[model samples]
Target chain A: MTQVSDAPAKTRAQISQKTLRTDRWWEQPAIVATLLTIWVTYATVHVFIGKWYWVPQYHYLTPFYSPCVSGECVPGAASLGTWFGHLPPIIPYAVVSLPFVLGFRLSCYYYRRAYYRAFWRAPAACAVREPHQKYTGETRFPLIMQNLHRYFFYMVILISILNTYDVIQAFHGKTGGIGFGLGTLIMLVNVVLLWCYSLSCHSCRHITGGRLKHFSKHPVRYWIWNRISWLNARHMQLAWTTLGTLMLTDLYIWLVAAHVFSDFRFYN
Target chain B: MSYKAALRVWRGDHGRGDLADYAVEVNEGEVVLDVLHRLQATQAGDLAIRWNCKAGKCGSCSMEINGRPRLACMTRMSTFTEDEVLTITPLRTFPVIRDLVTDVSFNYAKARQIPSFTPDPSVGLGEFRMQQADVERSQEFRKCIECYLCQNTCHVIRDHAENENAFAGPRFLMRVAELEMHPADTADRRDIAQDDFGLGFCNITKCCTEVCPEHIKITDNALIPLKERVAGRRYDPLVWLGSKIARRPRSTGTPKVPDNRH
Candidate 1:
């Protein structure tokens, strides 16, 4: 604490601040790093092992493979037509859109801070200094790409819309009738959380509703802005939730597609 | 009825210091500041502490009780068990002047760096029309009492002394946000925010929001929106080119003050 004595009175000496925190400061960042690493590992493995990311019977597509661009999609699974004729074997169909999705998260304000603090330990917690002599911020080359978050925000909206379509398609089972299943619910929850994350984005909030002159003139926009404001308040929570559910949605389809365990179908 | 509590308050100057223990009697409704006042009245007449309203409103009594930044007048005596040693210390992020007092002129210096609201003259002659809806969020940000609690809690400059030159902590950031979001304010500050104010330094850990006594959503509402403005206008390749084209000598009548937005 800063203490400059006033007058001729007894006062102890002052200490320069190194780390003023007393609680378990490192524990939170360590745990966040662990959780993020697990998610990243799972995502990387699944993105590469891409075969089991689809369940043709349920029209269920894991987020990693949504807008499944490769012709290798299981018969009838490439609901969106293959852009290039089916890929040569070995390459995953999901590779096409995954970059944009990953970019969305990488450029996310919350995740940017999370990884910067947790992984890089740049002032990891309140009142704890990093070893670095300088902070370049997101100003240079690759880090500068973080400013593309607004564009990434736009792309995620498009990807989320595609995911929404896949989820809608999931409602129709193999028999071409409305169906509900563990996988359908999984895709549903995944899309919902994805929307929450995207809509809660600071960029999304700003574009859709912020920086306004008269919200009164734009009543509908203002209303949506307020609801989004509610979501943005918990943006960090939704960001983490989307990651967990995104992993679960992919895992459920992976298991069901691999026939490791059949999807528990409720209706078809 | 009164309860006995042991208080370990930091006592020192810039040269050296340690925790000095004081046993004080506290009433049920009293707060940490009341205990300090009691300590002043009874045992330690020479002890120094900063305070104003004695209520939580003025924000004059901001100090860390235990490890968290808070208003000493707001934290209740009952919140702690009688045995817990109440560690009262000055705000850790600043340099101390005496016990429980740190020189917060750093914030004032940062405040002077900001340009005040400059409205577009074309809008009106005297009156301006702002929809309540448009002004709502700015109103929330205006609730800030300048307690600097959020500044004290913010990590951007708290521990990283090197960042002090570039980064303006949560309080001034909120000020910028309030003005930027103002309905009539038309001066473009996006580039200034990014390049000068170091808006990119904040990672939005929410510690500032957690410590705010006024419940301002410093991270989500102000800082993040300000960031979007920075990202939207300042870094866009097209806007970058456009601004380069529009760049001219700064005699647009807007007083060529030495771009103190830093």
Candidate 2:
């Protein structure tokens, strides 16, 4: 073993000087105004004009269900419209995106590090910075937005099922009884993929699993519980996946809305 | 793509220190610590690095990568873009030695200061049984790997160094809460938690939970509950009245908060 020495020695008071300079540039009125405007405009447009069609309309290229008569099979026909019944609606999209956007803006990693730089450690750069200012009542208005995760989980599950229906509808495209479109299938795939990603989130898992202190020792039930716990263990993966899929879901819809990608073909 | 990464090694000891930069070539899978080790082995043999397991299981490899408190082994080189310069430094809560290693003895000292578990042996082994629910409550706390990421990320300690003497931080509060909730362990750490451990300092920002590599809910589970217990003593009118009434000349209420610091 290499000889370890107490070469570095300092009193607690002495180490306090290692504080570093942080930036509050984002808090500047101009920057705040610009960010608010962009966010507000995006929300307003997505809510009123876009009509949440970006997620539902472009979902067209997935195979969900096939009518199989034992060894024999027939394709089932179901359009995206039949599955979703109607568009997801713009008001709900705006209501949902509003908090998510604000949550990301008001309190996030960037602003956190920014505050750590500006306030906690000041006038010098240190390896360990001081704790940023405690956001006392901040947990109320913006942080309460986190509570929306429960509702978001429901949306994710619903959208996923709706998308799964679309995928199944693709496989059963037997006749013109609302046969599946590739666009709707893609949207369906998008929802299912994102739903798998979202449902397995840490917040969701904790909301469900973490609250449970005891369960009857039934091997069958315990097995299912353990599976959920296992999913919770990989919550970070789910977090990243949900983030990615949400973007993809929006992009697929946007391109179709803009007529950038005119046709989305399922079979190569 | 190969990018020129800066290896800012702390050359001098505590008083005299400077961020000396060494340009090094980095690959996709190589981590910040990997780059540092390469620098130490080839470029600066005398460079000081406190690392045991590169797998991130041991907390020995904790350092600030580009001004973020992350386990060096877990940090991938790919996280940084080509044009970015990565600043590597020792943990802030502890004092730095030569380079990336800091004095983590503070954690050990704090741990020692907290009263250890004393099982009520009179109850006898197998005599005491608790519901699976109560046991499970503390089980989540026992999962703490003691990475001190919670300690490091805790604003009470990370920002206000003075709180170190009084406050136990989020990590140890979880310890106190674990002990307090234990069925067999018959010691009261509430007062000590309030005064000495500085449980009130934690504003429940959950920065500790967020930055935790182990992802323990130090704020939600441990610290908040401990604070509530302390508040029960200090403010809860009903509990305060009960404690006051139970104060017979012979009957001492809960054990006085134990002296934690040696």
Model 1: how far residue B224 lies from native, Å: 1.2
**Candidate 2 chain B — worst ten consecutive residues by lDDT sum?**
B248-257
Number of the top-ranking candidate, with lDDT as the measure: 1
Reference-based lDDT, residue A44, model 2: 49
| Tens digit per residue, CA lDDT, model 2, B1-262 | 6777865555665635667788888877888778888888778899888888887777788766665567888789888776666766666666666666677777776677666876776888778666675577688888776667777766555665645666666777888888876766766676777666666555455567766777666665666555545544454455556766875232223444444344
Chain B TM-score by candidate, in order shown: 0.90, 0.87
- Alpha carbon lDDT of each predicted model: 0.78, 0.54
| TM-score (chain B) of candidate 2 | 0.87
For A97-216, candidate 1 gives per-residue lDDT tens digits of 777888989988889879888988775776565667666666567787787888787788888888999899899766878887999998998898899889998887888888575788
iRMSD, all candidates: 7.2, 9.8
- TM-score of each predicted structure versus truth: 0.88, 0.53
Error of 1 at A51 (Å): 2.5
